[model samples]
Target chain A: MADAKERKILVAVDDGLESLYALSWSLHNLVSQTSNDTIILIYAKPPRTVNTSPDGYLFSPDMMASVDKCRNDLASSIIEKAKKICREQGDKEVKVEVIIESGDPRDVICQAADKIHADVLVMGSHGYGLIKRAFLGSVSNHCAQNVKCPVLIVKKPKSSSSATGTK
Target chain B: MADAKERKILVAVDDGLESLYALSWSLHNLVSQTSNDTIILIYAKPPRTVNTSPDGYLFSPDMMASVDKCRNDLASSIIEKAKKICREQGDKEVKVEVIIESGDPRDVICQAADKIHADVLVMGSHGYGLIKRAFLGSVSNHCAQNVKCPVLIVKKPKSSSSATGTK
Candidate 1:
């Protein structure tokens, strides 16, 4: 028997398609539609965006405003995308909440999960190899070690295995 | 409705308590005891043991044999422990398998999961912070990035939240 209270699942989302894949996977496999679960979709922007340029010069007020607006818009769009996926389920009893923060994703995600007391944290792997270590990636590694609750890192399914699990 | 075929779940376990906690968590949350699923428990030993002297100087052939025997014995003991956990479910239809490999755990785990075509890979997080980085840890991070299938890095339930999710 399932509990009456809602299960809070915090899913970390970004611009990558893998994030959406993780979203759909958790929606279908992990979330029990019969239960009143709350899906908290989170998006974290970099803290430096609000302050200065890459060269350490103080950002102009106009530039700062534009960057902030751009980040906010991106967060809203992704959260809307997640909302549309939830709507497809047609589970009217379920609730969805969106929270956008500005910080390093590795630390921000773990802090958000703890602050919200999330039941579980779900993430997506970017599949970067050793060569790509210089670029942005590896947050999942840090989050897995730091998050207090259970964390599920969903892989982007290959073409052949993509539609197989949905059925 | 659950599938009729068996689900191959490769769980990466170790001598740590987090591993058994992950084992029991999967048994309760992920494993469909009703389904004819196969659980493969895997443990990776370090590539080789360390010694102060040359390859064949300090570690004589007999001493090397004894060390290898001890490591194999530990692996067997852990496998037996995993089997006992499976037996507690009393799911006669469900099968349990054990594998022990010697290599870097990060690379070995992902390779094993792929070789077996595992439906899902389960891992336990030791929650080791930077201070403890000198020791072996963080294999789950690498496995999540490389493993083809979905990876569940289960966090050991905190004392206050341990009994909260059973329902």
Candidate 2:
């Protein structure tokens, strides 16, 4: 087999099963063993919340530090899980890179794809209702329109097989 | 190089350059030479118009037949172009399938993907303004949400390089 061009595929993942499914699908389908493709795992950490709560309670510095620590730990664990998926799926060792950014996931993912000059950005869609999607503003849709590289949006199959037909 | 599992990739094409660019990109990047993948080219032909025009003028059968003929011709040409791209890109011969359907593109594309049981659906994004997108309701976004298989939205870069950054 002839060697194929190496690609840098940036996969935006979170704790959601949808994104994890996308990550595994990419490994099985997109990445060719002959090609030296690098898988970049990115987790967009939601920014730290305001010190004051909605109930008018103020948080102490120690409390804020603990919250930050918890967020960071979660990010690390997510990255580790994604790395394991990449490692276990393909027998050959593939290069793995991780990016944990704190900001709107929409913005962070697009920036990371551009900054790394990724050949493609693979992400998962939440597949929410129109009203909910309007409020949440579909991150996958946003990235697909804004990103420079091709964006692959993988939708997890619905629990009921019948839901697949109706949009 | 190990042989990869063959994939049936369904690419939705139109007369626009954006879709053609996506077709070419897929041929170059997505298909592995070692795998016996088949590229399915789908063209969603717009449904025929009513016999009467908006001016309340009743049209003859000849006029309606001519209009349908034109639409069919356009669809044929588009499919031919996509097939040529698939043929000329790689060194080996890859299987190509064509499907020409008449209906709303969003529905037609999604239905075709599911019917074929495609592993991935590749299409292009027009990347119009938000107001325009709101009015037209982006077809790519609809397919991403509804299709059972993964959807790859390939965005054609703007003529001006500066437009790449700001969403």
Candidate 3:
């Protein structure tokens, strides 16, 4: 079945350079792998906390609307930027689906992949140092362990030090 | 350098079924990718602790000898098993080098890759769950983030129950 062609490839994106590399790589490679492949660009939105009263109810309709508007705006901006990159790479013909879900980053990515029956999950590794990683383990690592499909973690090219040097 | 025939591909062994799959896949794919690629089997030996006085000085030369023996035994056993796997796969011509180093797994693996100028690093994703991962992230993640070369993380195919039922 290796040659059957993966129909769906999921690209999990965070505000990271490596994730962008993964997106670019997916735009280039997925088309070669399968014409029917769909690129699902997923962004995990962090949940907003609303202070609750003793009655255990929180957030009025107006406040909820404002929060929803902010979320939609953020999601749309990310999607637009990703689309621009895809266009620049000249893979506009490849189907791209932008998905924004609220929850833990790793959980949302894995759940979305399963829900979409993704054959491959493409992502970038935010290579944190040993101390940082020991305290706050990376999301990419968590997803790789939990996801069902193969995870292609595109590393930031060494020469592209300008992009990944800070993180 | 992309087309340069990979002379050596290092596979880290950690006594996991997923690792076996990764090893098998690497053997098949790397050999197909290049005609004369070698497989280097590396096993990282954990550090040994010598008995120390209350003031944190070494106990004695005999204690140091015991620690060295323990490290050697651990490394040799893993190397022996890896060599056996290579032989069973009929890769005598591939020139396997079984290396053993006493240090962190990620550090040792990266050092081995650099020392040999390995073209690729291959390992398996153990599919640890959220709680376990939160406690201790997998080694595959650490290697992927820290290593300079390309890393291929092969995920274990999920059982039907977990695949179909869980998020």
Candidate 4:
């Protein structure tokens, strides 16, 4: 029965401790040790701007290539750290998949969830205040509203609740 | 050890299939059979309005009592149905608690979650569009941002993704 329905749980992670905390929570809470569930770890890198130069300064070809490599390296490191967390916290039998895409994190996460038909999408809340969240729209909020599957927004305990302002 | 920490999971339910679907999903995906997890089912009934007259017509004392009784009955029925679902879907060992409160759902849910220090808050998305959601704020969305704990917003499969409009 466990093998019959393999749930694909997509976890969006980043450098923030909040996202990593979410991944850990998912491992301990959602993924069953004996079940044939697949954990998909995704990191959305900032989109590369190899062609466009900020402040009208044209980038050399080598500079552009180096910048791209730097982003790729960061993405790989994040994924590796997430994988380690899964191995330590989750069952060994659970399959883990990795995805590194270059785009807005919100778009990348929602697209991947829909494309993979993920049973659930797990993410971390940035815990931004009303003014900040209004200025810099929350990625988790966007995905929660947009994603087809269930979206789990994990808030780190230390972060203050955003609703305090309303009260 | 599963016994070391028994998570308190708060699930807010209503008459809609969306909330019930969320409860079912939580039982299957979050609760471990062997763990001594407590599932708290909460239903927030619309606040009593016995004193308010809508059309300048005072409600008689008996009429107001009947109205209050009717709301109470509805709340009891909803809670009973939710309890039955928990018994059917969750493991027998898992503890179940029920709460029926009268107030704005957003406030009732957030306060209960905070008061109990729930490990996770589960809710169902109403699938309201932008205009509708704006006109009538989404309780789940409000709770997700306001609740201190992790929030799991389950979207019924048939409900169209709200992200499609922006796409």
**Two-way TM-score contest, 2 vs 4, winner:** 2
State how far residue B17 of model 3 sits from its true place (Å): 2.9
lDDT of 2 by residue, B9-69 (tens): 8989887777877777777667777677899998888777578988999888899989999
Any idea what lDDT model 3 has? Answer: 0.64
Summing lDDT over every window of 10 consecutive residues in candidate 1 chain A, give the lowest-scoring window: A127-136
Query: Which docking class does model 3 fall in?
Result: incorrect
Candidate 2 displacement at residue A152 in angstroms: 0.3
Q: What's the TM-score of every candidate structure? A: 0.76, 0.88, 0.60, 0.87
Residue A7, candidate 1: how far off, in angstroms?
Answer: 3.1
Best DockQ goes to which candidate? Answer: 2
Per-residue error for A131 in candidate 3, Å, reads 15
Question: Candidate 4: deviation at residue A164, Å?
Answer: 26
Model 1 lDDT, residue A159, Cα: 68
- lDDT, candidate 3, B56-123, per-residue tens: 88779887788788778766775676666655653234668777777666678878877776656777
What candidate 2 gets wrong by more than 4 Å, as runs, is A1-4, A55-57, A127-135, A159-167, B1-4, B127-135, B159-167
Q: List, residue by residue over B23-130, the lDDT tens digit for candidate 1.
A: 666665565533456789998876765653565567777787788888888888877877777677432435788888998778788899999988778877762334
**lDDT string, candidate 4, B66-108, tens digits:** 9989988877887787777777766345688988888878899
What clash count goes with each model? Answer: 0, 0, 0, 0
- 1 versus 3: better DockQ goes to: 1
Candidate 3 RMSD computed on C-alpha atoms after optimal superposition onto the true structure: 7.8
Candidate 2 DockQ category? acceptable
Off by over 4 Å in 1: A1-6, A33-36, A46-69, A89-94, A127-137, A158-167, B1-6, B33-36, B47-65, B89-94, B127-137, B157-167
Sorted by TM-score, highest first, which candidate order results? 2, 4, 1, 3
Query: By TM-score, who's the top model here?
Result: 2
Chain B TM-score for each model?
0.83, 0.86, 0.70, 0.85
